[model samples]
Target: MKARSKRLMLVGGGVALLVAAVALVLSAFQQNLVFFHTPSEVAEGKAPTGKTFRVGGMVEDGSIKREADGLTVSFVITDTAKVIPVSYRGTLPDLFKEGKGAVVQGKLEADGTFRASEVLAKHDENYMPPEAAHAVEQASKAAATVSQ
Candidate 1:
């Protein structure tokens, strides 16, 4: 084969290999990626079964139930339009409370309940754990101040 033709063939092969590598890496990353959805969105068939995803919403009031074992807790998360039953088998964040926003990551069970492996309660802007309670307290003070 001519030298020029051989050089062109080598360059084309290099480009093809690079493209294949990128594609493989992207596929692996996509498989690990998880997305957040609201209770309403999940209820509308936005959450695919057996796939990992996150659901964020307010913890519905009077919906929390602790199992006899005390290690598992069940609650209903609501986004005003819909509610999703969630079960978690671990200690929850101290900020997790009723009528507060929270985000849970896990897969939806066949029984239509979300099996959350992790739960995160929303804090204030640029805040950390237990900030949700502080925020509520602050808001209560602000409201009282405004009424005074």
Candidate 2:
């Protein structure tokens, strides 16, 4: 083959390889990425069942129950309009408590409960995830408007 033609072929192959590598990297990133959803979103069927995701909401008052085994803990998460029951087995964060915001990452069990692999409690009394707080505000406003 001519030297010029060989050079062109090499350049084309390099470009193709670069494109393939980029595509592979993007695919892997997408597969590993987890998104945050609200408990109401899960109850409304916006979250994918059986797929792992982070759920942000307030821990419902009086909803936490520790099992007899001492390791299992169950609680309800609420975004005002909906609620999702979550079960977890592990030590909880120091800030975890009823009426406080939390984010739990896990998959939905077949029985409709969330099997949380990890839980994140809000940092302070006033701290809330921006998205979850917005959702709660919207829900309250919607309710107030409807009552009129």
* Cα error, candidate 2, residue 19 (Å): 1.5
- What does candidate 1's lDDT look like per residue over 1-148, in tens digits? 9999999999999999999999999999999899877676687787889999988766889999999998899999776556899999999988888887788899999899999999998665444334333333444565577679
Q: Give candidate 2's TM-score.
A: 0.89
lDDT of 2 by residue, 1-148 (tens): 9999999999999999999999999999988889888776787788988998988888999999999998899999888877899999999999999999888999998788999999999888789988778777776776678789
Candidate 1 backbone collisions, by pair:
none
Native-referenced Cα lDDT, model 2: 0.89
Count clashing residue pairs per candidate.
Answer: 0, 0
Report per-prediction Cα RMSD to one decimal. 6.9, 1.6
**Residue 117 CA displacement from its true place in model 2, Å:** 1.4
Error of 1 at 92 (Å): 1.5
